[model samples]
Target: MKRGWWLALVTTLSSLVVSNGAAADQSITALAPFEVFADGFRDLRGIAIDASGNVFVADREAGTVTRIAPNRTRAVVASGLQHPVGLAFDFAGRLLIAEEKANRVVRVEANGGRTPIILNVTRPRWHAVHENGTVFVSTQRLTRDTDRDGDDDRDSDDESDGAEIILALTPSGQLRLFADGFKGLQGLALNHTGRCDLQDPDSERRERRHARCGRTDEPVQEARGARTRQAGGSLPHG
Candidate 1:
């Protein structure tokens, strides 16, 4: 039996809607509770709203992508996914999905088709978009394996050794690391100024790791790498 671990903490950005006739630019306010969308979602993780206010959600346990219209009608748009965790958009009006288990990012077009954008990503937990047509993806270190007692230890850290990282992918498919040293990188976002703002629920684990190694020199707060937001740290926009 394979045990799975899911982060219970929900992170979100509230947005103020401004109408522009056919489309609108939503301004994020704060994190709000997830309101039930017709009561059919099981463990909904990542959400993305399109220009028309159509809500798209990636259901991890259901392995499906759902579309919730303004009328509160729920429909499964795609299925058979490998635990897709993050969802975003590209410059070409394509839906980008971060498939966590497959370590790949894929694109779903408007015609109900899918294409691979980037593959072999390192434990991508979530992703966000930038105005410059660049896509940033976050990687968390999660693995599933059977333990000695025949029980799956989903949170076991016996095999993890690398630090978490956020990678930026250019339009040409070139990948670059934007940030590093995150113990358990989860949700990632890029603000209007191209600054990457992210949150980690398991930051306490990193502190414990530092303390175990007798690293008293480390700051008791969040890691230094997380505090700095670099402009143009990502690839140039196409």
Candidate 2:
């Protein structure tokens, strides 16, 4: 099963129209693409590296979280999830997951069990790391029917409540939306001073266009106009 999935993913990614600038810098100098890691993941969306260098992957299609050890041994850390994507670790060593289908973020305890950390999170895809034991999540806003089948025209505000919100979840379990109004924002990260930054393929293009006019520092806020067209989604938190 895993072999088949890996093959499919490799074929799909090879055909994807990725950003040239970002892909150019992501290559590993010492390791070839095939040798960088094992070819066993199927629809792997997000990945997180622990302080000890262990790799945690969110397998969306498999609905599981697989941990890759330094020795390259793979094991399922958590399973039975509903399309888990973004995986992050809190300050106290809790495994946090953003389950897209469930529209919530759950935490795996030290005992290897799961608990709901935050729910109804508007299709969260990426998470941002913040100081003082805070984690920020990026959620997608409900919008017009992408399928154009005239199915989602019932509630104009249904997606508004779930609209792109950057949530700051405290270690003590408190949650708050720090920012909002992004379309399909994912891949969140924070700069040294705690500002949230994300990579949106559409927004990046807009930034490049503005760079022609010498606006190098694209606005450091939510990407209210951009959306993601990628298959797998995950938040990489350091």
Candidate 3:
């Protein structure tokens, strides 16, 4: 998916102008010739901006989460991570990361300490945090074999044997299966109405789907829409 190019484009765009009108009449205009915000990143998988305007980026290859301050100073806030691909902030302002290779999600402390929050996950790709301290993480389970070989193969594209689901983690540390039945679940975000939107690039019908969760943390219904680009960052709910 050319993730590197997508990350670069996201980090460089300075501004976006949207026409003030009705929902169907509004249009977006981008100011071209973007300026590079920061460089020297090996592979940027995720990005997040803190309340202080400091930009934090996860370099999966380097196993580091570097922070670029407003003054252009750079510092590694967290290191030695295992394939960190998604970044978000919890309701308490704690930095959350999805470590794909580690098969867990962790909270990055102020002193650069790592505390595992959600463990025993499989291919934790991306996640979103709700205002009430509910975390929604997307996971993918691929097929084991495709060529009739006895060995397990991870690169198999047999969707019939694969599955994708989203898990919800409450503030009390209780885990529950929130939603399922997806193809290529990549990213997640909470909309204004408190519904969680999932980006499934390989879905047969659509690219994005919004799943509304009930008070019991179960998915009530899902609505599909047109194709949309998926990114590795999430907005913190108020």
Candidate 4:
């Protein structure tokens, strides 16, 4: 159970993605990628660093969560999770994982114990933990089949809440749809001023098309179009 992983984007605090010598600035020195711990990772997905400088890796295929210590030693903190992807340390240093196949997010303990934080999530992939303990989760596809006719032909799901949705989960366990109508939402990041942005792959030519949301009950559009106004930037406070 080796725990090494690619450590480019998760070096210290921020990650910079450069292309074709785009970052030729003298102040920016390109660093070589290094493995932190032992090798042999079956499927490494999301990576996170804790407050204590400990590195955690999520193996979606192996169904395990591994922690690489500051001294380079590795240990399995949690296991048996289903397709754990995005990982974030909460305010208290607890590891929260977005379990995609499980359709929920779970808090992993030091002794391999797990506490289900949210449920009924559809393909929850990446997530962000707000300073106030509010979790913002991005889902690929949600199935809200009202008619139960074996097909999710709901007008609401097809219109606004279609194949993608951003969900907000409160510390008190309340869940709400933050925003919707996205195609390639992958991860999430929040700036110091408390604005939400998505890590999308489909925004290549549309680079500036980041879905930024406010902390209020109103939704913020990614400047998408008319449907964006209806898909306000905030969720109703629980």
Candidate 5:
């Protein structure tokens, strides 16, 4: 049987509002937890907030993306998606969704339209958008069916050798292979200094490197026939 996940927005009064001036010094007792939105999501995977403060979430099981307004109103942004996992806002403020099962990343336009930006991604799980419009996507290697049964087996004891990788999509639509050889890569983010960090929960390691568009100070595996450089050193496992 397939497992399911749920998403809920819970907040405390102290986190909701802050005081200024004289009231700031006073200790405010946190109010009881309250749910902003309680239901209507199936297996929520990724979430992104736009400039207007609308919260967008991807429902993997439901194959839909929903937007929740600040006033707690809900709206379906896109539907019938194939295993949409990660969500981010691009430089132009368009919603970027990593459609895992579809092997593509789609952009949500302001006019409520969907456009495919990055295609042929293998098991795209999470992505982060850089300030300069570069999109970094983490993907898993395809599952192998060692047996001749013609079905992909993902049993814990199956001994599959799938590795996770990170790819960068330039603003001009060029795809570049950023990094490789990760296991169970989950979260990806970019710091203020333009350094890219990714988490591999399976390996219990956090990897970070400065990754810039069209350039790299450290070693990186580039796409196509571009020169490949080995990583400078080993990162300490967390």
Candidate 6:
């Protein structure tokens, strides 16, 4: 039997309507204790909130995507996914998802349809959608099957060897290698100044890997990379 890892989120109900002035602070009610949403799910990972405040969560272990409404009702938007990890809202208000084990990014429509936006990505753990509908994603190194039994190696200690990268997905269905030379790239984000500020904890002898990713690329933080530069050095021109 395959032993499955699980992560379940306990939903908290907060008091929504508060009055004006200091009376609001004094009369505010406390939040309810966290409880399982519609019972339970497994291995939750990336989550995002839509304009209407609906929370979309990716269940990594269960291969499902769920929507949590303002009224705390739960709905399964997508199921039978490929180890989904990241969730975001595109410029057009569509849902975007990243799958680590599946090595792809997909767009989910309101009618529950899915289209592959980016493919052949190796370990795409997290992603973000820009205003122009571009997608920036962080990926890790592909695991090795040392024994050649069709399963990747399970040993995770010191796994930051040549396995960090960022990818760009254009609006017109173009995929490009945006950035590389990271050790343990994980999550991604974009700043107002539009610089690629990487969050690499495995930076052998450096603080972080801040690449000057083009407007197409963004920033992300996760695993560690080997020593590439000295502290406070200029961002690598990768």
All candidates: TM-score: 0.63, 0.62, 0.68, 0.66, 0.71, 0.63
Ten-residue segment with the worst summed lDDT in candidate 4?
223-232
| Alpha-carbon lDDT, every model | 0.55, 0.57, 0.62, 0.58, 0.64, 0.56
lDDT of 5: 0.64
Better of 4 and 5 by lDDT: 5
Query: Against the correct fold, how does model 6 do in TM-score?
Result: 0.63
Ranking according to lDDT, highest score first: 5, 3, 4, 2, 6, 1
User: Can you list the residue pairs that collide in candidate 1?
Assistant: 14-29, 15-27
**CA shift at 94, candidate 4, in angstroms?**
0.6
Cα distance off (Å), candidate 2, residue 201: 2.0
Question: What is the TM-score (0 to 1) of candidate 1?
Answer: 0.63
True-structure RMSD, every candidate: 13.6, 12.0, 11.7, 11.2, 12.6, 13.8
Candidate 4 structure quality by residue, lDDT tens digits, 21-130: 33343344548653224345666677788767787888777878788887878888777777778888777878888877766677765544566676656656777777
lDDT of 3 by residue, 123-213 (tens): 5768877767778887654333311321233432234545777777766656666777787765677665576767677764433344443
> Which 10 successive residues of model 6 have the least lDDT summed?
1-10
Report lDDT (Cα) of residue 214, candidate 4.
24
TM-score of 4: 0.66
| Highest lDDT scorer | 5
Comparing 1 and 2 by lDDT, which wins?
A: 2
Candidate 4 error regions (>4 Å): 1-38, 144-162, 205-214, 217-238
lDDT: worst 10-residue window of model 2: 206-215
Tell me model 1's lDDT, rounded to 2 decimals: 0.55
- Ten residues in sequence with the least summed lDDT for candidate 1: 1-10
Cα lDDT of model 3 overall?
Answer: 0.62
Candidate ranking (TM-score, best to worst): 5, 3, 4, 1, 6, 2
Residue-level lDDT tens digits of model 5 in 1-238: 1001111121121133332432346654446654324244657677766767677878887888888888878888888787888888876787888877766677776666677776655667788887777888886543342112212323322224467778887666667777877887767777666788787777788888677764455465445421211223221111
What would the per-residue lDDT of candidate 1 be over residues 94-152, giving only the tens digit for each residue? 78887666566777756666666666555566787666666777764322221122123
| lDDT for each residue of candidate 2 in 92-196, tens digit (9 for 90 to 100) | 777888877666677776667676766655566777445566677766643442212212334322332443656566555555446554554546665444445
Quote model 5's TM-score: 0.71
Candidates 2 and 4: which is better by TM-score?
4
